[model samples]
Target: RLGELASLSYGLAMTVVAMKTVTPEPAESGALVARLETLSNAIERLPRVIPPRGKGEASAAPPPCDLQDQIAALTSQMEDVVAGGPIERREKAPEQAEKGEVKKKKGGFFVSGAFSDPAYSRFALKGTAAVMISYLTYTLLDWPGIHTAMLTCFIVSLTTVGETVQKLFLRIAGCLVGALLGIVSIVFILPDTTSITSLVVLVGLVTLPAAWIAVGKPTVSYIGFQIAFALYLCILQGAEPGFDLVVARDRVIGILFGDLVVYLIFTRIFPVSTLTQLRLDLDKLIRQCRDVVKTKAAFDPAAGAIQEAGRAYATLETASANLAAYGYETFHSGNRRLRAQANKLAIKALRGFVNALAVVAAFPPPQGDAEKSEALRQLLLHAEMNLQTLAFSLAAPFDVSSGALVDSMPPALSPDDEPSPQISALEALMARLNNVKMTLFHYRRLLHTEAGAYE
Candidate 1:
């Protein structure tokens, strides 16, 4: 307590010292102080008239325009003139009431809305239905292994109906192929073999081809996964004896049951097309390309642009291939082949554009070529603007009857001849930009031609 009191006293002394140090001297403040005193004396000298008293009468307020009243009235008029209007009025009770009111909040089962997103809701309902139906089918049929069917239903479920159906077909085919391969390996190659070496060889033979396929295309990767799964089921039933053919048979049946259930549920409700997904992916790709061009021209870091480019390229490629495959599998009206052809050509052009941009972006503009560099920058900016325009048009539905797609596009830039070392980078960048412009023109031309053909 003594220490606390000493600390408090020290703080008080320091505050007093600080106040003295910062305060203006009396000599410096004398004029302001004198003015304030003179104003007070003048205010006191102003006349104040007392009201006449009457017997049993209360004194009323002075008239509004007396010498004191006139000054007060003039001051109020001056204030209103300066404010440009009457003084603002406020109500205390309304403010107090607003402050006092407490907001009512929802509670209890209202928390369920958190999980009620439409996209995820569809996923949940579809998955539940698929699993329930699969399990019920196996139970009714008295299948030996119902677990595989339940598991396959979960594994084969995808974001869209088209993708799920595609994967289901691939998975079923892979299962049949894998089961046959496993059976051959067990019976013909190494009959009644219990040696670890033989088993390793068998597994390696089946897995190598499957892995190769799995690494090839994103659309067909599920086939490799299912193949490996089936091979494992058939070849690795138990350590006892050699192989179990019944396991493969049961798993194949389970897979078929799951696929059927998933297909029925997915096709009947909330089915999203592979083509629609492709367009969205293409939109993303174009936007990423725009960012790359704009950021590169601004001399900002290009790391994010490169990463986005890679991802968009991969996604676009996968979606394009899937759309083509899906189109072939299903019945599509209005010249499906022509649409696919146009889409494929556009994808090809986009790939060229991405590759050229990547190459140019890899090299920065050489120093000591300010004029050339500025020219290059302007060209890049111009190309970026054209790209944005093209992206916008591509996003919209085109009509041949309205006009050709090429008619609305920006004119392509022509590349100049080769240059010396000093301006070589600029020349090279310009050439790539020209190529990009030409590809875009070609892409638009293809779209126009296809549209005209369809019409």
Candidate 2:
């Protein structure tokens, strides 16, 4: 009876896999071209913003009107910061400035007194959770061989560390549910090892619901493992002979223990996000912004920038969501400050993202006016560099000095500032952008202060 049931389940799953129907992923190609073209133009206009051959210390920001050299200096600083500029270490963290680093050393791990991620530290807490649970269960029930039963951590621990809780939890849930269902079938329906149709039916049943939920839910990859785990448990696990209920419970506990090990480990390992990945996401937005500009040379790039900004808003939201997941995983004392700073920067970046997009969108195509195009190009380059600096900051754990994270976006070219087939709507947009800079600045400061408080 069990053999026939298993065969039936497997057959149905094969059929589902044969049909490849999945939603289309968002495209990055359209935006890539736009980002490149705008960047090229920005490069050309850079000279106009800076004094061609001036040699001196860089100024903080551009003077509001026609101060091209001032713009250049600001632009250059933006680039340097993004490049990580040599880590001069001039500005101090507010806490360090107040309390001093030496006085605050309490149970902190350090490499040359610099706190960082360590694999052992990250997973240690998880091991505590697991071992405590196991020892307690063993002590209370005296499940035979409790002293020798599953005590060592798996080798997979090192590799799986740093995965999000959502993923870990989803897989854990799927594996547990799948394993139980599999065992139930093996015992009640698949008494024989050589059944085909019954197995197919089982596979199909599990896959159908797993696929649907994975597709519709936010974190879907776990569904992929759900049926796989179910198949493994149903067919293979039946060989393990023991008290049915206790054995199943122990397996569930073991799976959870493994996941917690990985989760705890990831949070602790000087778990820095890569600069390259951060670069990729920002580059994606930049490319999208450029694609809009490419539609028509005379067409203002502001509209495209606005669209790209919309994408960025989504990106930040995703980052924030990820941060929340990390927090829920396991508490690591060292990561506390880094998390505080990152959340602050993400919030600030979102505000800047909106303002920058709107400001760029309001620009006019210069009415066949080459000089105007050149000026707009200069602004775009500066804006892009500012974005790069923001991106770089988010990618690593480094101290930002006073005024480090703050940035003033490039001004939008006004309708009155151009001769053209006048568009009233575009001009009004420019006026609105004039006030946007200060608002964005305010938000950035909020994040900066929040980061400072924790640091």
Query: What is the TM-score of each predicted model, taking all chains together?
Result: 0.61, 0.42
**Candidate 2 lDDT:** 0.44
Q: What is the lDDT of residue 440 in candidate 1?
A: 45
| Per-prediction backbone clash count | 0, 39
Cα lDDT, all candidates: 0.58, 0.44
In lDDT terms, which candidate is top? 1
RMSD of each: 25.4, 18.3
Cα distance off (Å), candidate 2, residue 247 = 5.1
Which residue pairs collide, candidate 1?
none
Q: Candidate 1: TM-score?
A: 0.61
lDDT tens readout by residue for model 1, 320-412? 666554543353346556555655665666666665555434333334656655665675676677667667766766543533223222223
